[model samples]
Target: MKKLYILGIMSVVCVFFGSCNDEWKEELHSQMISFKAPVGSNGVCDIYMRYQPDGTASYELPVIVSGTRDNGRNINVKIGVDNDTLYHLNTEKFAVGRKDLWYRQLPENFYTFPSEVCQIPAGENVQNYTLNFNLKGLDLNEKWVLPLNVEEDPSYVRNIRKGWCKALLGINLYNDYSGTYSTTLMNIYVDGTTNDPAIVDNRVTRVVDNNSIFFYAGSVWEEDENRSKYKVIVTFNEGELNKDGNMAGSLTIKQGDPTSGANIVPVGDCTYELIVQKHETKPYLERHITILRLEYKYTDFTSDPKNPIIYDVKGSMTMERQINTLIPDQDQAIQW
Candidate 1:
């Protein structure tokens, strides 16, 4: 009786396996084409590009054929600018009345799509589409987003889930000198009154070039209606080695927009000192400390455009950059 029971169990297992053999050979998932770009909380993929001297940069966008098996046939994926989606995103994120704060579509002159169609060759699972950028005169004041879409085609099945077919690339550029600096020591006061001063904890600097950066004048943040007019450009000169073996240099400060009502002038000798030191415990880490001693005076025109208010700013701003010695890529090496 026990032998007969064992034989019955073996026959049942054989029948189940034989009946499911054909199903196992069938494909379980569809072969769909999609982009590998991942979006952040803001619904845009933030891609960092190292600022170039000539104001040129390129980003390779990845296009992938998703499945358990390799692509069986060649695919020419159609691509285009999805302006409607970007418009909707801006509307959803920012109030319609706050147009100035809305993310702007990257102008056509700023970037060029190398090809409208990305080719995924047979047997390959992915391919990169090159996007060339010319940011020579891009106005960094406005938030820029490059919106892209994967057009539907009979050659391939397009993935519609998880933003696979669409990509909103938030273009961000950084240089050696461009970043947020601690402004705890910096103080702002009314043109003549110095007793009661206002201090901001931090300020962000925008990249002008490899050695130059710009920031809004004291107390005037980016949200100011006429903030661009109060731009303060700081250019670092070639450094001379100090007694401590650290590099120190004079800073050239200038107003960005001359036509504005703000009468900007340097109050004293502007300079900067850079100190480099190795991490205490981590051998593969290095720290760069940049101390900028600034003294300037500028008028805030936007608060009351008709009657501008003059403000005097003084003291130093410090920025620290950490570099990972093991990372080969300069852009990825720096802890941004």
Candidate 2:
């Protein structure tokens, strides 16, 4: 595959939040290898080999290279496959913890190198690693990956952070998942009790690509003092859908009352995608979501710094939407 990022001016990604700390910020500039692009807005680096254009079975992923400079010149680096760091960073950077991750393999033939030695040119800050895989060797109906970490070199440095120096390659090819699915969010109490879904169950499409979909969850505010808008973000990335044909992905719930979507927390082991008929038309909806129903109780920290609260989330939701719910702008359509 060819390079995707523009040269000489690679863009810096979004600031790592909630999990953001001075130590992490310092580590960002520290000697290490990291991805060049932000993992969409939801903080997930998901690339869907959803389809092959022009009979290509290769995917290009750009990576950032930085390390100690010996004397005046920065050290030239090589990011080879490192089997040592066999774990996801599971940090605030990816907005996901280790427990929430699903790992897979893209078979042995799919190698993570553009050549025998993937090198970062001397004085260059970026290098694109092209994943060469045989599509015919992969099962389109199942999910897979090309998991990697910064293979340690004797001369250069690598980020020792939990989430850094790692890449989870979710490789698959299918693009039928594009639409506004109707949804129902059941807010449960800490006691693990449920209630009727009060908020409107619907999702509006924000952006759609060949292999992924980004959409805002339908939200409503409750009165604590004044009405504030809460937000839910659902992202379906490449190879995210699992073997059971369930839409396996991540969700971010935000309360605007205090932080205006800044106070976000990801619920563990939540929703799944199901296909059903709606008004004589069939569409895939992210319904049948049962939250906090896991055997192991999970706890997470809130965004509060001074008086941070450690809390547990137990909720269920049902999301359903029709394909091509894209509201084409009338003006633009007329222009076309």
Candidate 3:
């Protein structure tokens, strides 16, 4: 009786090992093709691109094959622009009925796909779809999106999982002086008085061109529907380095819409200084610091169009951008 019990246990072990043998030999999950783009709460993947003048910048979007085992055959994944998806996404995201706030589709003139089809050879699990961008005249005021989709093919299985087959790429172009500036030292006061001041900690400046950027004037920000009226465009003109190893420059400040916008006037000579320093401990780290000395005045019409108030903004603003020399990619090198 004991011998029979031992025989029965051996038989059960053999069956269990035999069943798992076939499982490990082949993939149990479906080999579905999908995109590697990850979206945020806004349903868009924010990608940073370094501004390239008179040239094209390239971004590689990864196409992945899902499964435990290697891909058995080659895949020619057809890619196309899906504007309809972007239109529906905008409507779903922003139901506030504000068209200006909606994301705009990137025009064809700004971007081009090297190949409409991405080829993944046998035994490869991933490949990149290259998108070349010529963002020379790209407007930064409007939010831009590049929507891509993987077309369904009879040759391979497509990943039907949510957000796997589609990618919403939000393009953010950055230049040398276009970024967030620390505005704690900057003070805003009513046109006549300078005692009590209103200070904003941080102010974001948008890129206008290779050497120009625009920011909201004084305490005015994006919350107001007519915030565009207070737009202050600043163009940097860099000069030779001074004795202190600092490059001095002057800024040309202008109203975005001179005719129909807030009456903006410069109080003094608006100038800037740039300083570059290397990290003491980390030799691979480099820091670029920009200091802006500004004194400007602008009329605020959005607070109450009927009763507009004039504000006097003065003092210095600073921005520091750190670059890692170890990274090969320009976009990834910035600590932003």
lDDT of each: 0.88, 0.43, 0.87
* Residue pairs whose backbone atoms clash in candidate 1: none
lDDT of 1 at 287: 97
Instruction: State, as a TM-score between 0 and 1, how close model 2 is to the true structure.
Output: 0.37
| TM-score of candidate 3 against the unseen true structure | 0.90
Q: How far is candidate 1 from the true structure (C-alpha RMSD, Å)?
A: 2.6
Best model number under TM-score: 3
TM-score against truth, every candidate: 0.88, 0.37, 0.90
Query: Which candidate would rank higher by TM-score, 1 or 2?
Result: 1
Q: Global CA lDDT of candidate 2, please? A: 0.43
Candidate order by lDDT, highest to lowest? Answer: 1, 3, 2
Clashes of 3: 0
Clashing pairs for predicted structure model 3, backbone only: none
Q: What digit string (tens of lDDT, one per residue) describes model 1 on residues 1-336?
A: 999999999999999999798676765689898888898887889888998888899988899998877788888999999888888888898865878877899999999988889998999998999999999988887889999999988877889997789989998888767788999899899889978899998998988888888898898876776678888989999989999999998999988887877788888799999998999999899999999998999888778778878899999999999999999988668875
Indicate the residue-level lDDT of 42 in model 1.
73
**Model 3 agreement with the true structure over 1-336: per-residue lDDT tens digits:** 999999999999999999999779988899998898899887898888876676468898999999999998989999988878888888887757677778899999999888889999999999988999998877677789999988999988889699699989998888888889999999999999969899999888887778888888998765556767778898898677888989997898888887854889888799999999998898999999999999999998767789989999999999999999999887889997
Q: Tell me how far the alpha carbon of residue 148 in candidate 1 is from the true structure, in angstroms, after superposition.
A: 1.0
Query: Which of the two, 1 or 2, has more lDDT?
Result: 1
